[model samples]
Target: MQRYFVAPEQFRGGAVTITGEDAHHALRVMRMKPGDKIIVSDGESRTVLASVTELIPQAMKADILEKLPQDSEPAWSVSIAQGLPKGDKMELVIQKGTEIGAAEFLPFESERIVVQYDAKKESKRLERWGKIAKEAAEQSHRHRIPAIGPVRSWKELLATIPDYDLAVFCYEREGDAAQGVGIGAALRKFREGKLLSLEEGRTPSVLIIVGPEGGFTDREAAEADAAGAVVAGLGKRILRTETAGIVGLTCVLYEAGEMGGE
Candidate 1:
């Protein structure tokens, strides 16, 4: 069944009202008619088996047949703090990151980042990124769409580090060779300490910051480390700015038991 994400308020009593782009997708793209079945998610980990009831002009209304138990969301929430990269790479990061179970995305400016959004078109780009996340969520059967934060500066990004239980500053530095333990060790720390760090029966949120094309400068990485982020590397091999987020996130989710039975 085709899946769509909708706001909770869209479910007005008897049915879910699909609007905007999704409405066009169903009415024109999918050519869906009354009695067609689909899965509608509330964007908050709740979903339902719904059947089309009324085609309200450009919109489509569907009556929820059965409330489904959402099992797609991971137990641990991961927030990816990605350094701004050039061109459409951010779009790729947002799209693939959503599918990989990122709870949210934060784009920041690092010393070596090469891209900058113009003042006139920043909102438009943010909107587009958010849309990509939503579509990817639907396609991947995710419980919720990942929230995309506005592009922030280096200092601004560092200030938000305390909000997470674990903040990994993904650096291609000395790695495990000369620096501290690699990202693998950092993930291990969380795995072994997850039970001890639980608050109100919920796993703590994690933040992983990936540098852009040129990677993080030594001074910048030091600042992040001083700000409470664990500076770690993916492995001995260096990854591009766009590739690091997903790689780091997969490792985090995998180690945290979000990718399988724990």
Candidate 2:
């Protein structure tokens, strides 16, 4: 069944009001009629089965039929902090990141960032990235759309590092996985070191930081290490700015056993 996301306000008294581009898609593109069943989610990690009841002017109404059981979200929450990469690579990052279970994306300006976002273009870019995340989440059957954070400076991201349970910065200088410094080894060390004190069912929150095409400077790596990030390598091969986040996230989810169903 096709799915549409609605706001809490749009869901009233067991009926969901689909509006804007989503409604337009259902109305014009899909040619959906009354009695067509579709999945509707509140974007709060919950989905429901609903049937179209009426098509009003510029809006489509659906009656909630049944709330379906869903567990698409990963066991742990992950946020990607990516340094500004040139061109539309950030869009690809946002789109694919959503599908793979990143909870949020933060774009930051690093010393090596070649791309610059002007004050006027910031809002427009943010809006477009948000739309990409929304569509990707819908297609991936994600319960919630990953949030698109504003582009910030390196200092801002570093300042937020202490907030997460685990924060890893992908550094080529860290070398290959055999050296016991890759994300996999780091995560294993973390779990084994803390299993005694850590409680079960307490999902860990993670932050993975990836730099741009040019990568981070030596000084930035030093700063990140000081800021409490585990400076780790992905593998022997260096990945592109767009590729690092997805690979890093996959490694993280896999390490957390989030790649499998409970």
- For all candidates in order, the CA lDDT equals 0.87, 0.88
Can you write out model 2's per-residue Cα lDDT over 99-153, one digit (the tens) per residue? 9999999999998888766869998999999889999988999889988888888
Q: Point out where model 1 deviates above 4 Å.
A: 176-179
Model 2 TM-score relative to the real fold: 0.95
Give the per-residue lDDT digits (tens) of candidate 1, residues 57-157: 57899998989998888778899999888999999999999999999999988788787657588899899999899999999998799999998989999
TM-score of each: 0.95, 0.95
- At residue 197, what lDDT does model 1 achieve? 58
Model 2 regions more than 4 Å off: 176-180, 195-201, 260-262
RMSD of 2: 1.8
Q: List the residue pairs that clash in candidate 1.
A: none
